[model samples]
Target: MSLRFSDTVHGVDLPNNAMLPPFDDAWVTSWGAERRDGIYVSRPMTLQVFHTRLLEHAKCNNVTERFGVTRDTGAPAVSDGILWGVASWGIRKLCGTERFPAMFSYLASKSNLDFLTNGTQILMSDKRHYPYPDNLFNNRAETTPPSTTS
Candidate 1:
């Protein structure tokens, strides 16, 4: 399913193109308890789309220049940490989604640069970084939305 960003996140409205990537059940489940806790409840496709758009925006706007990234540096080589921070700020100030604060909190807690950098590929490949006992959405009738309260 396609995922669209809310008009605003944390008082910031995202650009019209900030749509998330496609959904994947394996990736969503890989988030483990965070998915169940609602802290990482965004559907896998939705989150991926959001992240892809975030990175594309950063590249188009030269937002990575502030982080010492030069034009010579391949876009893919840029650190996800920088991108995440930039995207997070954008989501907080531009999109203003109510869940931005919660997402920010979750990011702070994880605080792993690699996680953000490799997250897209990892999720897309349906690989799990950490073992989860079960897929929370597997048995649920509604795998999206209503299942997540956050």
Candidate 2:
């Protein structure tokens, strides 16, 4: 019952460290973001993470990639969204897994996302955000070729 989600990240500022905040309807409303066809594109987010809501909770050890997000506003008229980090969740120890891959990431269907979050969130963080605490900001030093992954 181990469920994992990983992807070859794109357009992310390398060495990115982010916190996908838990779904908060009020907060989203505050920023005037709305759901369309059951999806949300929160304007309160900056680079896949909340810009100022970073100190309200402790960081969770892991989280699932539950939905796709698109940024429809920016200088170029549309800013490509940020990275999609991985999670090794299994109904429990969701404190997950991530791999720096060189190619071909998995594309799971909506049913797959349902299997993970039980239909409560479209794109939510797992309740937390701790201090950046270090200069490296999680600089990864390892990367694996995509072909050999399990």
TM-score of each model, in listed order: 0.15, 0.18
Q: What C-alpha lDDT, on a 0 to 100 scale, does residue 78 get in candidate 1? A: 13
How many backbone clashes does every candidate have? 22, 1
Residue pairs that clash (backbone atoms under 3 angstroms), model 2: 88-97
- The TM-score obtained by model 2 is 0.18
Model 2 whole-model lDDT (C-alpha atoms): 0.25
Candidate 1 C-alpha lDDT tens digits along 7-74: 55322111111112122111110111113322333434432212222223223333322221111111
- lDDT tens per residue, model 2, 1-150: 954546853232111223321222111012223445545545555334222111112222232322222231221111123222222222211111222111111112223333434553445222333232222223232322123245
Q: What does the lDDT come to for candidate 1?
A: 0.23
Among all candidates shown, the one with the greatest TM-score: 2
Reference-based lDDT, residue 105, model 1: 12
